[model samples]
Target: MENPPGTIGPGWLIKVSSRTARPDPGACPTHLRTAVRPLVAAEPPVPFRRAPREDFAPGPLFAALDLWEQGGWSIGRVLDELRSTRGAFRGRNAPAHPSLMAWTVQAFERYVAARHEEQAAARAAGLPPTVPVRLGWTARTKKKDAPDARGGQQYEHTAWGRQYASADGSVRDLWIPSLGRAKADRAAAEKAAIAHVMANGAPTPHRRRGDTPPEDATASTRLPERVRVFDFGCADGSVTPLLDWHRTEVQNRFMADAAPAFVSAATGAGTRPGASCVDCKAISGCAALHRTPRLWGAASAAPMRGRRSVSAWDLRLHGECPAQYHLVRQLHLNDLSAENDGARRGRAVDAWLNQRHADRPVRGCRDLPIPDASSLPAAHPLEGPLAHVAVRMLTEHRVLCPLNGIGSNEQVLVQHRVTAYVPELDVVVLAVPDLLYTRRGDWIWRETKTASRPVWEGRSLLRSYPQLALAVLLFSAGALDADPRRSWVELEHLREGRGESRLERIDPSQPAVVAEAREVIADLAQPLLDDASYEPTTGRHCHGCQARTWCKPGTAYVAEHPQGVGRHPDAAEADHFADRGSIHA
Candidate 1:
């Protein structure tokens, strides 16, 4: 017997239970019948009475909407029903605006229009029309006619609820998203979607130990294939696979274990508060997090707004930690910082570089002007000692920098932003360079990275960084005349006032270089299209993560990992991709 995972109610259920017992072979050997034994003592017969039915109390339309989601209704199916009876929808949660009602209705309109045209074409061709089935949240099953009768009558009712099966009734593309709801919670979407996925009839490959064959079968149980679920923010009725629930082999094994540590799983506090617990409404009720004051900081923090386009910073953070990415980007948690003071200071220097370069407006050997503390705007935080440090770094770069005979006469594009449309990825690729200048009529790009450790010790490591690799393609495909042999992109490290003496050259003309460059960029950019692909990879960098207090895995890793928190080697380089300032905020 076991209690369901997130229940506050008193509900217990047998772990391995069946509605019917082992069958008797005498009645029907092929399809076994329920076993029956002769009664020793017969009791007085009682009048037949069916189970009492509760009155259907409609609270609001949103409640039914939620129930349909939990019931695994397809997007088209749910929207079609909703569109027909929107005016008569019960409940206070019905949309206040008519436009809000059109969200799913629009999607349904397209589907219906396409179907009508398909029917017309089929009729003209003298063929049968293929009408798509809009399945309701019910399954047809045979019910026992009498107490002793076995599977005599069939009726339509909910068993586990219908998953969003395809037109041909395939379970492969089962996905449910909370559409067109503005205050829609991520947790609620996950709960509704995952429940539907589990029940949607994906066949599991694994079998139970105490299983029986058809000869002695009662309940014809089969392993349900694993169902993949995607949770997207602001889904807009589109099931974009932006993120998915990826369980490690260990996690899978643990969940599949016959005996699991229920107590530990239930009351177990997170090793450390992470993005998952930041705005958790149940923290006060949770005994594990109630005593932890450090985690409380996240709850006080605000959230971030949604994004119109994706950036390198977006990809990197989402790759590093999906939870943190959601908190920073989806929630717009601006008050929280993802990087430490030193890395943030480096970004401040980048801003200073842009300002300094803009003043010269030339491609020759130039000097970076130091900013005066008094000259900073009221919003700019770099003042006093911080301002002095910024000036000192600029001065140090002027003297120690090794740039003299690199570019001939091409104009310099400081803080240059280059964009390319990648149709395969369904989004534009953003390739921003610190300084972009041309050589031999080909644009040469140089990116300044502020890191405690050298980003790339050797030239071989240049191919590994997609920001540079992607720039090669973005520049070549454009009118920039980015010749592979003449033009090159360099990664300059801005630690202790040192710049790249020799830049890494890109041979864009070479078939190998072109193929490799696009492949690398595509691999990174492609996953962003799907919501499920954004999974968090916990590592030593978790210690310095600003969202660490909100990340459970991050905290657990900090406590259990060998790196032991603080500043990791990859921290600075990874954070160097902050949307570089454009002189203004």
Candidate 2:
């Protein structure tokens, strides 16, 4: 049998093949050996030191290395012992457990020995060894000024010296591998773990022993003194962690100082009133007076009107200009067919309601046992005329009608009003339908009889503005009415049929909120009015506009702002000219 190219004994030499290097038939052994030598010599096998049996203990490799260092074993002896204990070396297929231990221990030992040797050599020559000096890592303290050489103060590794100086001044880098990349991965994992804990309370890889508080526990606390107000879209929850840390630190400090009094108070032991009271003052004065506010109150607040016009004119103008604000307000209705498995579920629901009412004759009803319809009828109704009406209103009036556009465009106005007598609690959720209302509030949710069924399941369908806005308006009204607890607005998406909702609880004093709400409402109401100059904004909406054929602005806008619209018009023109020239040439 003939051996393959670049093979010497059992080992193979990886090399580039060439037509000229092709072996001739009946080549001599001497010629073959000559051909393979250069290739084999070009690439040498990597030589690695092995670890001893002692290093292969269950503990971490570093710890094992530390033990070996203390024992003062020579490098050669250690390698020999490791090989004998772990079994004969099997090249690449060797078990990782022992190999990892050996690699780590040997690497550390070699590094230490190399440094010692270098030092000894320097000392013998009567010269100082090149030892690393501590130099602190720099951090950005302020904005860059043109002439400032030292940008910011740095945190130095006082013990480790310049050898331990991280690329970034962050201390976390020193203990981890591929500092930035590893830290990022670990951070992402931690964030996901925290979110999991919040959503489902699942155990995470970061789970530690003992009673350690969560990273976000302090921020989650309803304490007054540690309260720090933040604005919307403030760098993706950066302040939340800081606030949480600060809160924990403050609480820990306070508890440490007043430990005796706190323990005494908890045990009902006799304690000086003034002493205990002084420590409790901060807790008592907390702005978050109420821990859990009335859920009903939070639910009743009116929905703030979003800035999107459901009118035709606004749609047309939006189709033309497609401004950033317009894009922000624009609602993209999910394809019902795709979303609900080709059922056209919304339309089917509407049809059911329409058919149920078609044959019913008007009659006087005094008293009768209301027919039970579906499960959970006692709790609320399902698949009834009311549900049909909501579905119809959403699909036909809201979805089909160009005038109504998307209901998301309609601004649900909300106000944080003082409804209760609580002095401390000022924030409340309020859900309002339209701005127009009477003194006692308008009738929103009215009880209507279903033709086919009597009693339905689940809560009543919010038939009117008052009913729809009940969760936001009334619930929030009660929350703000008293100073008992936290307040938040819950935007329920009934259309998705998934029962998914978004909650945004904000401080009452947040200035941007009211302004944002006002803007949304103004945009939504645009289509309702007679705006002659209303042109279709053609950015994102042009693709979805039902009346795209009739929309002149949509056509013109797309033409003007082609895909990949660059800031420099001249550059775009030049590119176009080049393309044309290339095609001709």
Cα RMSD of all models vs. native, in order, equals 25.2, 32.9
Model 1 C-alpha lDDT per residue in residues 1-585, reported as the tens digit of each score: 111122122111111101112121111211111011111111221123221111111122333445354556665666766656534343442221222233334434433343355347546965443322233332123333342222222222121211333333322222332322222323332233233333322232233433211322224333223333332222222333322232232234323331132222222333222222221222223222212111101122211211124555665565666555544444333223345545655667676666555554342224434445554334335655656655555555554332434444556677665533322222324446887765556666777665555545564433456566656665556524454556676665555433422334555556667677666645544454344322445886677665455455666888888555465757654565665311000
Superposed model 2: Cα runs more than 4 Å off: 1-489, 494-512, 522-532, 552-585
Report residue 412 deviation for candidate 1 (angstroms).
Answer: 2.6
lDDT of each: 0.40, 0.26
User: Residue-pair clashes per candidate, as listed?
Assistant: 32, 70
Cα lDDT tens digits, model 2, 353-465, are: 22332222311111212222331122233455544444432332222211122133232221211111111121222222112111122211111111222222363222111
Give me candidate 2's TM-score against the actual structure. 0.18
lDDT measured at residue 441 in model 1 versus the true structure, 0 to 100: 60
- Number of clashes in model 1? 32
